[model samples]
Target: MTYKPATQDQLLAIRANAGIAELAQSERYAAAEPDLVEAIVEGVGQFAAGEWAPLNRIGDLEGAKLENGVVRLPDGFEAAYQAYVEQGWNAIAGSAEHGGQGLPFTLACNVLENLGTANMALNLLPMLSVGAIEALEAHGTDAQKETYLPDLVSGAWSGTMNLTEPQAGSDVGALRTTAHLIEEGEHAGKYRIKGQKIYITWGEHDLAANIIHLVLARLPDAPEGSRGISLFLVPKYHLKDDGTPGARNDVRCVSLEHKLGINASPTCVMSYGDNDECIGELVGAENRGLAAMFTMMNNARINVGSQGVQIAERATQAAVAYALDRVQSARAGAEDRSPVAISEHPDVRRMLLRMRSLTEAMRGLLYYTAGQVDRGDIGEPQAKARAEVLVPMLKAWATDTGIEVASLGIQVHGGMGFVEETGAAQHWRDSRIAPIYEGTNGIQAADLVTRKLGLEDGEALQNLFADIARAAADEPQLMALAGECAAIAKWMREEASLDDRLAGSVPYTAMCAVAVSAWCLMQQYDALDDSNDADRKHAKRVTMRYFLDHIVPEAIGLKASATAGAALLYELDSSVLAA
Candidate 1:
């Protein structure tokens, strides 16, 4: 069954968990009145359902294709993208100075959650564009901003990040792409860029009139490694004096990757300066490309976290719909012992509840993280540091949870889920890439323990644990979970070796993420009062109870794995370990 966008109620509920009301209080988002935000939410949900959801299966089955140096999306994919642009959905979170609606980035996160749930593959296009906006906004020169920001913010021209190469996936410093100063020509003072970038999302798509490639390349006389690389804006087409796309540039999509899923979004092998004519301009200060790229990367990281909630919501919905419809063997409690829906079975109910509760928790994590980003933007004290601390773990934890929930979704379907026609497997396949995208979840874990933990001398994480512990103090399990994580954080900081920290990072990240998620649920639970509708409060109670009772306990039980040093992992030699 094709799943539409998550319901308005669910999106609104998750937004509440993120404290949309609090965001509106900020001068940055003062114009985002409650009614306006609600209307946007409702409209985005409807658009996702009516347009994007229908293409999910089509895109998966047909995928995007490479032809004649251009990447062609599946049928209706072009129109859907155009519709997305035409609807101004892309502009919501953008800045007003650049033709955007100036809404909160948190709201945009909610919007993408719906679009991603509807169609993750197609959704990758604009998601990258938004990241580019953040990058240029922070680093673009006045001329660069005047030239590119409006179109990108308006979505008439899309954007992409080009970092990975054949040999340089995680190591940006190892990239072979090079940029040369164009000292004496019409394009003098610009650059001639040359390199092949693989796994470039939306690199050569025909959805927009132009694609602005934010590429990392080293220059002559540059230092070795990442510190030497610079950010360059390479356009697929040269801009006319009038600012519209003009002549075609030398860049082309050499080939498209055949992936396990999200096939509708072209993962291009983009070659720049095939004819030695590709031109680019510097973005920020020389040799500070990594700093500029991290702006987009960090933005993309948080966006990637939402992919977890997207797939989980879709998978959970599909699983529940199937469970409620597929009749199975007789239930002992059924009248006359007649056959009952699979949902009535004890194990099935447990899986369904687990799916729902985890989805809720992940959804909360996504919103809360995005809200932190917004808070940071508005200059809220400590918000920026906390967002840095949260982004890595949120990416690592949420994507892993998405995979878990998607797998459980398949399990809920029993035999039918193994077959593609049922569409359950696609969610699993589509979801498999989130952990690998942005940065591998392993990298996210490493960042969480290393740099993020060291932020403000670890005061940021200390602040986060304090809030969670305060909110969760009444619940012994949650309080213990918080305390254990606090103790572990301290141990990792002062005593554990780097290897030990890395070994324990994944489990430790899962612990903090779940504890934080539980804290979010607890906050929501506490906010309810007698004036709230019974059904609303009851559903919240059940979801929170299930998470606290089942999921929190399982996460809390990871103490041993989290604190276990790296010695055991390295005890066996590489040969034996591989063998």
Candidate 2:
């Protein structure tokens, strides 16, 4: 089955509902007219479906290999990456000052959706690089930007965030990586970093000339825990005084982890300063590396959420195609009927709709959150806060939905889905990591109920509820669900204890996502004017109804689970479960 990009009607509907057009009209993106945006999206879709999708199976089958401390990608992987760079896709939303196109992030989101659906593992390279470019643009010294940003934006160089270690996974403070200032050498004033970092994606690859690593290590006299941690810009190869690639840095890919999915993406264990000669420059202030790294992590989180949307879209497309082509049982009520496509079966149709509706909802939430990010980039304070508040929900909910939808896609394929040949299993395997990527879903939910809820004395959250309420006001069907969400928000803020809130944070996040997605769909439904094509409008209307009737009810169960408190969670003894 061929991969399909979102329809013109769907894209237009998303843009209209999410205020992407208004963002385009802003002075920052003045050149992003509707036609140009549509054309760029279509071009990317064509490229992704034609070029990247074909290599997905091959990449999965062959995966990446560790040969003599160098990570070698699967066949055709390097060529695809070169074509990606040559096409200038990496710079679509990058800053123009650094050789980027300076387009809006919303446009980038569209391109990435297609690319990721076509090939997820390959898409991760640019995704991580974009996050690195963002961090450098935000905190890198002027010289650093001048030396690194151009190559990163041009895709000639790739980037990696190195924070995890053998013992420090989420507890970044427990990391043992150390950096000492170089006293006397050509690289004096820089720090010589030493440590082992694990789970480093694309840490070593032949796709790029250089790999710019944003590493977190402790400086001498640095305090303990997260506050004492600092960020460093460490390159795979040392840079010459002329700002070109120089001697090989004391960094090596010690090994690669055999993974269940995204095998094409090299997950490496990197040893820095193996010879005590790896030089790294400080990024922000001393003992503030975590803060600087957050810039990259936050950007990566959104892209991870977008990954969820992408994989779900891909799975749904495959499932629907399979359902329409595979013949099985006859129609239930028809006498003397011949066997028909499984899509004619009620259960299969139900599964297809589940995949379709959830994918659409996840996309709406992802793009809407991205629009908030774009507005925030343009210095809208409220928009910034809103984007911050929604980031956790966006990451957790969308990824969870991705896993569920991918599993459903496999279910739609019956026995074939269980086998590696069907390709349905790959999506499920690939999506599994998204919940754990950037930060685990558990961490995201905890952040939602704790830090994000406390922002602006809860004004950010209140504003979200108000927006949903206002959007639901015009449509009576959405009112009850909107009210339920409002009640949950209030309970979360005023009634639930902190521990209780944490207990239900996952479900609470889901409830919020459902409400937000419902609002997005309602906006699209209401925006369908008579001038629009009838069939397109009708399809939107039907999807909106299907979501309301079948999917929105999940919010109620989520709300109940969210308010259930932590008592039952810890009541049982640990030994009972073991027995």
Candidate 3:
């Protein structure tokens, strides 16, 4: 399936709505001129479409294969990756002091959005590397950065987070991986990592020269559970005297996972220190590995949310194309009652509009959050807090939207959608894993209510609501809905029990996401108010109106359920609930 990215105008409109111009005015991002940013974004989209899009199907069908410890991707993947590296795409958001272009991280997110939409599986390799770069940049020793940052930033070597062991799913403390100090000659200072990790994405791949495995393991005589865990920089190959990749480390991919989607990207069952010589260097303070790994996980969570937007965008495009091309029954209201294309059918129109509007809103939300994160990075306290609130919503809500939109894509396809060859099924399959990973959507919602809502004693949420109300001043309907959500949030924080809060968190999250999404779309509507491009502005206007008319009310309807206490939920018999 072919992929298309947001237009330059659309991208800029999102940035404008998010107030990204403030970042450009700062000395930190002064180089991010409007035209330059637009050109770069458009160029990345073009590259994604032209290079990686072709590999989507091949990756899905061929998948990644493991043979005798080495993992391999389908043909053309390596060349496309090299093109990706050659184009300097990987260095877009890295630090200038560390071989990056020193641009806004927002633009880098845009790059990932585009590239991942084209081929999300293939994008995982570099995405993980970006997170690793972030962790090391924050915690790695100077020697570690000097040896690793150059290769990692340039995409010559990939990074993997080895957190999941077969026994430990979401519980990091349950892991049994062991690491010990090497008290020997040449490697005296380094530690040895020994254990197996499952579900390691891009754990061992042929595309990069070596894989940097960030392993979480326990040291001897340490406290048990999560506190005992320490992070290690275990590489596929040990570096030589000149800081180049040299000897093969003891780590290897014992096998590859048989997964539901993103097949081209290897999900490996990694075996570390089988020969008792998996040398690794410490990343940060001992017993604080979870903190360091969370730096990567938090980054990965947002990017995982981006997968939802990417898949939704692709699915929406596919649905729209199919709707325009596939003619079926006659439209009841048409002057000529002959059979018409599905696009002309009213119900189909609703589905298509829902897909279009929600996808656009999600795109806006992702950009808005990314832009705030950029501002927060530059010392904006409020921006940081608000971004924290938005991250869980983006991760939970957007991925849920992704699944919904992709399923709609299949529905739009009718019978053909169920078949694998149509690609609609593939989109849904790929999207299925999103909400389950990167801290499940439910976990995200719980975090929102339990943690983020309490920021500044609920003023953070109120501030956001107040902004929504201010933005919705002319639109009383949206203002009313926003108020309803605020009331629910207040009730959850002030009156509701923990059980009640947990029970209602999912609905509350969806409600807040809808309110925030409306807030985002409102910005787009405002940004396009003076646009000379008639079609673009009209599209925005209609979609905004569509969301207000069709979607916002559904969220409004969620108020009652959102406020419903945990009584009914707990009353259910366990056997019956299971049955």
Stretches of model 3 off by over 4 angstroms after superposition: 573-579
Q: In candidate 3, which residue pairs get closer than 3 Å at backbone N, Cα or C atoms, i.e. clash?
A: none
Please list the C-alpha lDDT of all candidates, in the order they appear.
Answer: 0.88, 0.86, 0.87
Candidate 2: list runs displaced more than 4 Å: 7-10, 474-477, 530-532
Could you arrange the candidates by TM-score from highest to lowest? 1, 3, 2
Deviation (Å) of 402 in candidate 1:
0.6
The TM-scores of all predictions, comma-separated, are 0.98, 0.97, 0.98
Candidate 1 lDDT over residue span 343-461, tens digit each: 99999999999988888888777777787888888897688888898898789999999999999999999989999988899999999999998889999999999998888998899
Q: What's the lDDT for candidate 2?
A: 0.86
RMSD to truth, every model: 1.4, 1.5, 1.4
Query: Per-residue lDDT for 1-579 in model 3, tens only?
Result: 567777654475446655667788998888888887888888999999999998998999999998877787899999999999989999998888878988887888888888999999999999899889988988899989988998899898888888888988988899999989988889998998889999888998889888888999999988989989999999888888888889999988888889999999898899888999899999999999999988877668778888888999899999999999999988987778798999988889999999999988887888888888888888999988888888888899999999999999999999999999889999999998899887899999999999998998898888888899888988877898889878877988889999888888888888888888888888887887677898988888898899988888888888887788889986878998889
Worst 10 residues of 3 by lDDT: 9-18
- The positional error of residue 139 in candidate 1, measured at the CA in angstroms, is 0.4
Clashes of 1: 0
Clashes of each: 0, 2, 0
